[model samples]
Target: MTRFIEIRNGRVVTPSCVIEDGRVVIAGERIVRIDRAAPPSTRSETVVDADGRVVMPGLVDLHGDDIEEQFAPRSGAETDPTTALATADRMNVLHGVTTKFHALAFEESPEDGRNLENAARLARAVDRGAGALGDNRVHARCELADASADAVAALIEEVDVDLVSVMHHAPGGGQYDAESFERHYVEDRNWPAEAARSAAEERSGMDDASQGQRIDRIGELARRVGVPLASHDDKGRDDVETMAAHGAAISEYPLTLDAARRAKALGLATVMGAPNLVRGGSLWDNLSARKAIEAGVLDALCSDYHPASLLAAPFVDTGESLSTRVNRVTRNPADIAGLPDRGRIEVGARADLVIVDPSPTPTVERAFVAGSEVIRASAGSGAAPELPARSRTR
Candidate 1:
């Protein structure tokens, strides 16, 4: 028997318009109907009174790395992959992210535990935890300067990777200025000043020939596997053109307005981090996402490192219609990620929805994935759920 659920009297946010006093009917894993008039509820159907709350499609986060927090909560503490992923899944659903791409970085960073081997292990863990609530996918971040192309290609073949983002995080360019690079290495990584300086100099002096070869090989592999390709922290027009030539259809976190505009002109989807929108600026002091949105250069917004930002960023005063702002987190990212089944409240779409109360902070009251409720506000009071307990390992 197909499961039936009816959510009535909510403000349904569609891609084209908002339906006031709307009703959404879910049958099994798909949405069967969405109308202003409530369909007659049968005894077998579970009826939920949304009380005029905002009922919108669940978010599609293309580049969230919050899972890294679960994997390694601190510098030395590491949780088992399965447990970490399970925790991450619950957190994502609570934040209305039904489809999330875990942006795992393949860099030569044994000090930080973000090495190629760890990337492969985490991908395997994501594969094993397939039964989790949200659609967990892998977005392999191939560091052009550190990871070998052959290793990335092998990892892609070994795991069910969904997206591949080519990035060159060398110091003195592309997301890191000289001063910021030194600060990050010394403060964030806890490296000594001399060691950090030496590493930055070495990275800055890397041969372009080797970097280009690695980029070409990873691009070819992504193309061959049919995974969507993205370029991370693009610097300018030339960087955009280079990524376009390498077959990257998505430009993730372009560092400058010029790069974003150029990527849009080149017909690549431009993705910015949602935290930038909520915080009103970039943490790295780069281009502002709000400015990109205002200039009509931004195509989508991801959770980036903060999953909660994905849910609240759209609700910020962007001067656009609710549907248009909502699409930044929903349909736009889904379209960029090549997922047609979700990110919409249309008929026959997957029933991934979030019921949110537009309070001061905008609480996620309830959430569903494929017609099944995965997160519900505690006591139906529209309060956020308490953080899950973490077991300490000696």
Candidate 2:
């Protein structure tokens, strides 16, 4: 007498195409059956009438540092790791993210948090809070210019991070020039003018020689841990090549089109922020994610800082099939991040799924994680749903 959840009358987006008026059956932690027509009547099953909504695989967000923002919303605001992560979990689950790689930055920021000490603390928090809502994992954004690369390496060993990305947030290279770097801290992040200028000067003065050594050390550690290594904000072909040489299988947020193309040519998956695509451009005036998609250089989309952007990105109708667009936020990222179990909505895949009502905009009606009802919402009128609005995701 096994029990299962049967969802009928939904537009199921599969690996190849969308099945209109499809029925998906989930038993235990796996999707058991899927068809255009319902199977035999099972008295043991709980039926959820989707009422002509869209059922897609849950989003796999590979690089969202929203947890960091949640922990410390403003400059002085400080919430504990557990509480902040719990808040982030509910937010991510509500937005259709079944798996979240909590990208925590390990760098020397002007802020009190976001340094090596605090980032490690946050990583521990993430490790402790795994599955607090969704399949939460850590994605370490290791800064190449950090004073102690050893400490950064130690953080990776401390927590079993799903992914590791090396970055150099300096004025001379990567995502910023000297002026833009200062402008970013001042105008964008709202840092004081003098402080931003000082930080910019300090970063620009970082030794490039040390950066090479840091890359080698951290890259070797990542290899030993068998975690996927990524390079962040690649500016050009040379940057892509260099990081690739040091075991960067993924190139995230390539600042220029040429860099993204180079990453693709070098067999590195390129990921851009969904907010970049949805908001029409980059905040840094860097590479355009829409153009990257047009050129066929982009492989995946991440939430970056905004969790809501991930769910709505694939639904913006970018000339690609709905399946194709959906995969950009789902299957594509899960595959890149070495998570092969839970991205697709196939029969054997893990039941990490989302039901969306796409009217004025896309809204996640219900979500499941590992066959668990993380979110339960009524599609049409009152249906006596079981879960609360802030339920977790698969």
Worst 10 residues of 2 by lDDT: 385-394
lDDT of 1 by residue, 19-92 (tens): 99999999988999899955557843689889989999999999998887799777667788788888898888
Alpha-carbon error at 142 in model 1, in Å?
Answer: 0.5
The C-alpha local distance difference test score for the whole of candidate 2 amounts to 0.85
Given candidate 1, what's the lDDT at residue 272?
A: 94
**For model 2, how does the per-residue alpha-carbon lDDT over 1-394 read when each residue is reduced to its tens digit?**
5568888889999988999999888888889898985664565267887889899999999999899888888887878988888889888988899898999888877554567777878888888774475888888888876754676667766677778888887787887878888778787677888988877776677676878888988787778789899999899999999999998999999999999999999999999999999999998889988999999999999999999999989888789999999999999999998878878989889999999988878888888888877877665667744454333333
Q: lDDT per model, in order?
A: 0.85, 0.85
